[model samples]
Target chain A: MSIPARTTEVIGILGGMGPAATADFYAKLVSITPGASDQDHLRTVIWSDPTIPDRTEALLGKGPDPTPWLLDGGRVLREAGATVIAIPCNTAHAFVPRIADHVGLPIVHMIGEVARYLTSLSPRIHTVGLLATAGTVRAGLYQEWLGRSGIHLVLPDNASQDHEVMTAIRKVKAGTRDDTTTALLTRAARRLTARGAQAVIAGCTEIPLGLSADAVDVPLVDPALILARALVSRAGADRTAR
Target chain B: MSIPARTTEVIGILGGMGPAATADFYAKLVSITPGASDQDHLRTVIWSDPTIPDRTEALLGKGPDPTPWLLDGGRVLREAGATVIAIPCNTAHAFVPRIADHVGLPIVHMIGEVARYLTSLSPRIHTVGLLATAGTVRAGLYQEWLGRSGIHLVLPDNASQDHEVMTAIRKVKAGTRDDTTTALLTRAARRLTARGAQAVIAGCTEIPLGLSADAVDVPLVDPALILARALVSRAGADRTAR
Candidate 1:
């Protein structure tokens, strides 16, 4: 199929890993795009099927495989004319390679984008703390991506991950955001910063919704935000290439 | 073309009349749906083409017609297997009849839903104020819908509409939210309440984003939230009917 000439690329978002996180990523996409009028923004299609099996549970061998559902969502996006695909959930990235192989679309890598963004910042930060789901940690998704760049990764201790970070993520998914969640996340961030981490990656999509930059002592990097920017730049580059 | 038997309806959102509002509506849809896991939520296809012409400007005769783009969006949704369609923007509903004619899909009527929701409230609001764009006010969209139900519609005064409501709506479109904007909206809500309006409708999608129920003394009804609920109910009904 011959793609039509357009000023912006059609971005296909394979989302709904958790409905709220997908919505948060989209809100950031809208906010960050510099557009005074409607036409200035990118053409986008979102396939939000919340039916995909939980990535974290699947990663931990506690649930069904999510690969089929991820592939199905990617197919939906591809059929919808998405020139590029982006998955907002960090844990879902574990299935990207398999999905990409099936769907045949370039996915803007979320972790890679965060690594690039962190390195781009002034002072050339190296050590970063990760506050993410246990699945993402066990899968070594970020570790694999950042290792090639010689960046050090600091993770929440197992207890902190199991009790604090994990609890906060579930609360957010259940639509609970209060001082308790904030305090739990803050303590986790402090532990990371005290471990000599220059910055913290709110690696889980739900984390950014509850934990803001001000809440952490170190810079709290949002992978979803980084991925959104990367998608925009990729779309712009596509326009220029055409 | 026969749709296969499914438990959920495929929701087609024709969005991007100011992208943030579309994101807000989608977020509400996600939250309102009763789902414990990823697969429990509805399958949604959002075509966010911000290139559509400005609805308010078209309604007010200040800009080009948005009907073509609206039709195009509707057709895209219809082609994508959307059994029912929804337009999140209030002003965009002005062109729905024409778009529905073109796409032949039933659009969940936003204003009609608001009218239904208002009547469903206890104590049964008879008089309601609307804080919306000048185009929506002048177009008499709500007045026409509420008129059939014998519900009286109060509006912001001419000066307040121009200076406060319109300015606040524009500020929201530009992604500006601050004390000044909040004050403007709060003052407008007070003016409506002062006119004996039992409740105020945040008729414009942008209004609910900046002016929440707590911002005003009188009950502030968010039309977007109402529409989201209406769409969900409609989708659920579709499943049962099938």
Candidate 2:
């Protein structure tokens, strides 16, 4: 990890992707940063409004439009003095484009960063399997990013897609990881591997609850972690050309 | 829950006790409210700046002063449109008195509401145990409030009090909990019951992780719930008031 320049970067995390994950990111900051104490970690501003319409629900039309609430989140973090902003929710990245224009601060894109990370992997793998909500998959976000780098992005077949992946996402949101949920996720992971996916992007943060690195043999890419590294970089973790 | 008057009463949550609970409260509004969509839940302004020095650390001299952070939390919420603010963090309630004057919004007291709940529990109850951080017990905030009602507030003996409870708080902040941590908390709860307490006010919001109502024979009061109820009332959950 590079030491971000000493130029006080007040990072803004647009969180509330299940409240626990937001906390996890902050905790990760503490763990990863070269800090002498809590104060030494990067100064951060968090606008964790979970009230925004559920991203998958909005995308599926099972819930209301998320544009206004998301806009509120962006404007909020912007008003709060975020030098740069990040949204921890994987699916919410869908609406970020609409809201980004309203906020003054530039957003460090999570999907873009993860896509870039996969392309920059050791030995540079050519393919990745995506285990995320159908909303994210249907939008072709990962596929679009990977396509730019001549990398192939794969998804589970229709039979295995919604039932396994979406169910795991719901279970995590409900704070459940019972044996049944665990088996469902394991089965989903197997299906992705069956599809010849070289690596699986734990695209939805929730899936990581069940499919840890030990649970599956394939390389797992956590979008949130990639986002954090991007944050550390944006915070001036390295002396590099922007 | 009382129906709030027509005026959009501003509710400021003086948070950063740890950022998770603050976000949890915000998410709960979106969940439990009668809104068909995102806009229906009460509009909330949260200041979850975790850089605020730890109230416990600050008060105990284990860390720097958190007064500035607490004051900043208050000022931000007031400027954001909160008519009255409720601090979700129990420890930070120590400075509510000072923060009230600094901001235009009236500060809702989490400790006061917990005291009221205890009072309504039974006519014979005069003593209640507080299982909170050393900072909270040292500050005498709750003891002072109960003293006004001619009631005694009991605290754990020195043996039962120390880093155990605070460590549990940090664990919750660290965003990881295992069965062993839960067992450690249960041991602490049993000790609180042995101290001749009728009820244990989960004095620190983090303590609820370690000890629950079932862990001890006595009733357990969660200060966060009291704060939540107070917020619901302010938002006009009471139809009679309407």
Candidate 3:
């Protein structure tokens, strides 16, 4: 057999917080990549250990630490020759710093990418709304990243967060995306828009499955898509660096 | 970090004929597996090399050979500790024997699984229609396998094969699944059923993206789903054997 030149970067995914979300992220990675043939895409190694303890539950102190599982997934990727890593789930990013510390591989930060993507928008979107899980909201992932970039994050009020956003996220996880979930999420986006938000960031990976740009008035920025783009760029840059 | 027991089988995928099909297959793998948490899902390693030369073109003697790339992908999976491998693309399976020979890893046969799935159906499906790429049809991958199992195979007329089946498959690869493509495929399915096909196998990976059980009168057996089930079963069996 002839050996072809290996010219692309291998992307290791620390995933499986929710299997569907991991699949969604991979699908986005394939969609956003500009490749004509089978070899044109980035070499991706996905360690989808759906057994990684719940990130949101862990963040809320209601579940076991996911650090061990995240680290294990990272090690699998690193040992598999992944030059860079990406975590698809937003809440999972809470443990990424620790995971990165353990694996010592560059992680394409999902929240940081969302912040960067929002900044790159045509009108320079500043006031953004976040519709994420309670754990991610409580952890202030988007708030911390976007705040550093001088972008204001408008979140749903506590009542809305508990009733609409969290409920919608659960419905999405349970494989239910009925009109009720869509209407509820749309209302939440409208409330954020009313609060002077320019666009809604589907911070939780599952949120984008049910809510889309058409469901909301302003653009619905998908962190998964943003992360996928960031990964492609990182992989391409790594190839050039090599 | 605690070293958790490695009990599950790792499924290495030789994929990326078209990136979307590979993603679709992985998603089906996740969806069909019986899992409660991340660890409940089978450990999967996917080497999605979209750069693998076009399998259809190669089989038609019109493009470069993909065997080298397939072998390379299999080697990646094998070195990553994959006990067994699966190829998502139906056409790519034409090179599986050579790949299996090179890697010395068991590959969950996609077409074989489809034949088995049809046999398992209630009332026992006898005449099966195949809607696949010209490569799969020309290579007689299904005929050779199903012939042994005593199942009858019906195919689309040459005109429909080139116009409808090929066109629909190309549209799916281009990430376009519009009404026009759907209609073209559904018409082809009707023609196959009219020719005495009891059920139509969405033989090509891209067919399922636009066509479903509801789209056609006869049962539309999806090879991807069948392959996913086979992979899950194989992984579970491997774990049990250990």
- Report the number of the highest-lDDT candidate: 1
Q: Is the docking of candidate 1 incorrect, acceptable, medium or high quality?
A: medium
lDDT of 3 by residue, A76-97 (tens): 7787778888898999888877
1 versus 3: better TM-score goes to? 1
lDDT-best of 1 and 2: 1
Highest DockQ: give the candidate number. Answer: 1
Candidate 1 chain A, which ten residues in sequence have the lowest lDDT sum? Answer: A1-10
> TM-score, each model?
0.92, 0.77, 0.89
Q: Residue by residue across B1-242, what tens digits does model 1's lDDT show?
A: 12122355788888988788889999998888765455667778898878787888888888889887777777767776677888888888888777667788888899999988888888888899999988888889999999988999999989999999989888888776778888999999999899899999999888888887887787888888888887777767323321
Candidate 1, superposed: residue stretches over 4 Å from native: A1-6, A237-242, B1-6, B237-242
DockQ of each: 0.50, 0.15, 0.48
Q: How high is the lDDT of residue A158 in model 3? A: 93
Which rank order by TM-score, best down to worst? 1, 3, 2
lDDT of 2 by residue, A107-216 (tens): 88889998788877788788788888888887777888888988887888877777888777776665555777778777888787787888888888677666777666
Each candidate's iRMS in angstroms?
3.2, 6.6, 2.6
Question: Chain A TM-score per candidate?
Answer: 0.94, 0.91, 0.93
lDDT of 2: 0.69
Task: List lDDT for all candidates, in order.
Answer: 0.83, 0.69, 0.82
